[model samples]
Target: MRKKRIIKPLMTRLFREPHFEEMTNEDEMDLKKQDISRSYHQNLETFKSIYSIPKNTDIKLREFTVRSLNRRAFIIYIGTMVDIKNIQEGIVEKLIQSQQPSSKIQDIVSYPIEKTASNIGDIIGFINGGITALFVDGDSTCYLFETTKTRGRSIEKSINEVLVKGAKEAFNEKVIDNIALIRKKIKNENLIVESQTITKRSKNDIFLVYQKDLVNNELLQEVKDRLDSIDSDKVLELSILEQYLEERPKSLFPTILYTERPDRAAAFIEEGHVVLLMPNSPSCLVLPATFWALMHSPEDHYMRVPYGNFIRLLRFLAVFVAAFTSAIYIAITNYHVGMIPPDLLMAIAGTRERVPFPSIVEILMMELAFELIREAGLRVPSPIGPTIGIVGALILGQAAVQANIISPIVIIVIAVSGLSSFIIADVSMNFAIRLTRFLFIFSAGFLGIYGASALFIVGLFYLVSLKSFGTPYFAPMTPYNFSAKDLLIRHVPIKEKLRPGYLKPKDMVRQRKG
Candidate 1:
């Protein structure tokens, strides 16, 4: 039996109206934590108690003077980020040079960030912004001297979301800068940035940005609930955090879309989907992303409807060509010889008659060569990279065909397949295309076009069956959305008024009804 020991006299001495036990327990926990943290520092108990920095770094910031705050106070901040000059000119100079004010450390001193930074959390943020931290001999609280130097990548076209013509500005590493860019575009008070600090890294800043009135409250609440539930040790970037947070990260198709362009992210917010902005990460994530969403690009809006639709449709065709080109060639050559045109068939036969490998083996060999060239080109420096890829592919591909190790037809097919693979902006989709292309080849080899067709149908079914954040992976197309204008054809922007029903998102209406 558990004994209930009541502290009757102890409760009365502690000046509290009620709930003395709970308060005592909480205080004990806090003291215990402080003791444990202090003990971890060993000889450096004074410095470690304040910042709680791990014991590994061995360097105790030799630049600054460390005085025991027996006088028990110490301040810590990254050296490069903190403005030493500002600290000397503003905080330390002002404090030490002046006639002493009230003895209590709580004297409301006049400082820029200090007004909001009495606590350790606020001060830490202030220092991270390049402000220096100031330590008084004995005070428990630390003051961050604002001295963060201007440092970050200039806003430019993001490497991933490269656009021929769209907003030139892409998100830089700074969270505030990125948000400011978007806020400048919308200029609405209703735009809400619901911030969260994940338990993983207490310092990580996450913003769930959406148009307040436009976004349903329930949706916002759900976003908050899920964010609260996320528990991890450390989150360095938004992509890593997203994998853990999203409903179907294991799925091959990406349900969450991240773009460096604020214009695109802002548009998603306007349509009432949640956009998560993470600190130290330039790319912002859009939830409930669909397959068609990956296919669409920001330039789709910049160009006139007909041109946009034509380009999008072209992209759709390009995907098929990339995926099925080699497979179809292998199938037709090895299994369905009758399907090939008579003249072309004769030409292919003449070319391959000299080659010894089976059509499948030849196709796979060429594809592997192309992939190797592509990968090597990407891995090296950009200046030499593209040149190496072009020279390497041209030389190797030509030499392979001449040597009779691979057929000329296989060379052309592999080249086209590799070229088409790069057309899709999303790398993951490219991988999917690359994988499916080989499947198509095997299908054609085994059962010709019939097998290829059946495999494609089955693959498409799995694609449609997949969901991103509970939204249909192939909506408006698979379910046959009546408003196919935006999905396949780009009607004049005005005609494509309503938002896509793919997400069945909280806000359905897009453009204001006339």
Candidate 2:
């Protein structure tokens, strides 16, 4: 009977369903949902349990007596996230040495009280955000102090969006600094910076920056609705939040433009576009991005009108060259050889005499090689990366040509195509153009110029139908809205005075007619 009883208990213990985890989660949730208790001991015990005291070494719970009010109190904060000097000198020392007998808790602390909260959940949030929460004996409300010591890099020059003549400062990983940078540019009362906690567990804050008087109500509400609808436990950065906010997640072309330049973001905000900024992301996302906006550079507006227009024209041509150079080469050589001049045609034929592969195959091999070199250069260490790229391309191209693996003209075609892609400023647009180039190459190989043209028309149709937060992708040009004629070439600042009409901004005129 003893043996049987022991075996039965052992079997039950071994095969029992695991509910401890579920039960623990439920209890934690209940604790988080509870309000702060009037009894200081109860609050202290609750916080200790929630933070797993003794086990969680980084969470500091310092208990002290406020001599002024003759009340016992404790402050809870994450040790690594807060400043120890401020807590010791400003909060604890000031409260202990105060002589005001009837003074409130806020009066005793030397640090300014940021806010007060009664719910356990809010206090936890405050603690997590690097804020110090003070719970007093008789007071139910917990006082919060701003003692966050977030570490981030100082403002540095823009790396990706380098400009010869513009604001050189780029945003760092701090959202508060980014907002200050924008505020420095625009000192208007109407400029608004509204924040919303998007995630449930992480409580990541996303800032919506816009000119309140100029921004469309419907557009702002739409952005808010999308942000509020995010059902994730954590959305840590603007890059991740961008995926959640975009209308079409699978679309090849990016609807929003991401820029690290605070000046660029500020310019967009002044023009009635909404900018999304989040902590840890060194860039801000500009919404309702049009093709023109993606293609434009800050240097365009900084330079003289003629110079800006000249560069803009070159960039516009470069886009086509990058997307069509290799594809056109394949089409002409394989299917439209008759169009070539006799001398040129004979020269081309002579170069390819030793080449065994078809023109399509030859071009594909070169394109792939170029892409590999570019990606390798980006991924490798900065010091040796450029050297590797230059030497690798030189050696690889020379070897291929000498061995007659690829024709010499194939090298020229790939080089020009790759170089032209760099003129595009926006990373997402650069990727879109590069990927579409491959599609054109495939189409051209199959049906020559006709296939390429057909694909181009379909792409145009797609762009026309696409919308970023209700603004057309090809706005002010395709839809013929009344705005500055800045599509292919931007006019001088004096002449370009109206905000984009597609945004339907509350105020249409940027400057009054003189």
Candidate 3:
């Protein structure tokens, strides 16, 4: 027998596959090397093979004969997503009538052809929207004929963020559709959308929306840098993306603003903030957002200027009341009875006497009950949600007070606080209100309203210190940007000329009063 030669193998390490294409020239003898074109083709076929596009799918695949060109062509489209009559005139008629003068794709010139499309994916993209790609048999080049979908929802009032007066249309999940909506308002070249692939496996779409002139260059760089730093395998939702880009990840207050309304998003884009739109989510994020920005609704700008201002002022007051009402009630009854109105105090004390629980216990129980009802209303179906909100809150509060487990005074205070909390349009800010409520309640129990007042002062200082992309959270107050609040609190349309002072605003005035 011949002596066996034992060759110790090098490079034995094996690991997970990288999603990116690796350009390498190693020969087939080395199994570690890969061919990009071949690999891409394989991946395409594999993906196509595995995908179960339902038969109900309207996207049609038709192969037609081009007699003039004497070549066969394939048409991929969804009927509702395009104007069929245009296709007949612009594509089919031209293809059938025109004679082929050249064999090369580069030499053929008769009509506009979309060049951005490179492969099967590009073909799929055109099929889903305006522009249908015609792949001629034996020719690698494709013609993208314009045939964008038009039959869809007209701009209507948004159901969520229901503005008793603002623009109703919300941004839909479709990326291009959302982009068009924003374009309707900001008809400027400066408005830009920077595309990014959020998912490696599915290639989820993410757009960084901003007006180039107004947005902070440093903040914009930071946004891109954070996104680039992500080494994750997938990015399926907005919450995940927010955590990566946000400056303070663990903080209770939301550093980014999320909205479903297209107008709201468009307004933010014009105000020197950066908006991000996701592929399939209607709710996209607006970055470098201030604390005041969240409390506002587009209606605050849309309604009569005086009405809008009054509502804004009311909201400002409501926030303070909702955050401190219960604590004030606790402090007055338990510690500072002298500060309370004599008759009212006597009546409150009378109600408290029947309750088995102490003032703190009673208040906590009522607050917890209100939260439970709110949770139940949210989780339930929309049709019945309002009913639950009404029945659960009214019936449960009344029953609790009647049972004497919680006092009637507790019920009244909780009701006012809950309703007041809802006055602020943004959901993220309510967390602050909720947090402050508890702190105030505890402080009143421990050292009366004096402790609560001190806590409020600290809270104000903290809010002043917090920054979003270098723009102070309390604009016009802490950072003292006069140009900010005119638009922020809602103003006379003709007079409000300047943009918000934030995110390193490139322009202060959008229009000048002559």
Q: Candidate 2 lDDT, tens digit per residue, 6-119?
A: 334333432352332322565566556667778887777677767877678999998989998888999999998888899889999998898877668766777999999998
lDDT of 2: 0.89
The candidate that achieves the highest lDDT relative to the unseen native structure: 2
lDDT of 3 by residue, 207-304 (tens): 99998988878888877777777777677777678887777887778878878888888888887778888865667898878887888777778888
List of clashing residue pairs for candidate 1: 69-72, 69-73, 130-147, 130-148, 131-147, 131-148, 132-145, 323-437, 327-441
lDDT of 1 by residue, 139-238 (tens): 4445554555556787777787777877878998878788998899889998888787775335566888888766756656766777788888578798
Q: What is the Å distance of residue 468 in model 2 from its true position?
A: 0.2
Per-residue lDDT of 279 in model 1:
73
Off by over 4 Å in 2: 1-23
Q: If both were scored by lDDT, which would come out higher, candidate 1 or candidate 2?
A: 2
Error of 2 at 149 (Å): 1.7
Evaluated at residue 274, the lDDT of candidate 1 is: 84
Model 3 residue 26 CA deviation (Å) reads 15
lDDT of 2 at 310: 92
The C-alpha lDDT values of all candidates are: 0.69, 0.89, 0.70
C-alpha lDDT (0 to 100) for residue 195 of candidate 1:
84
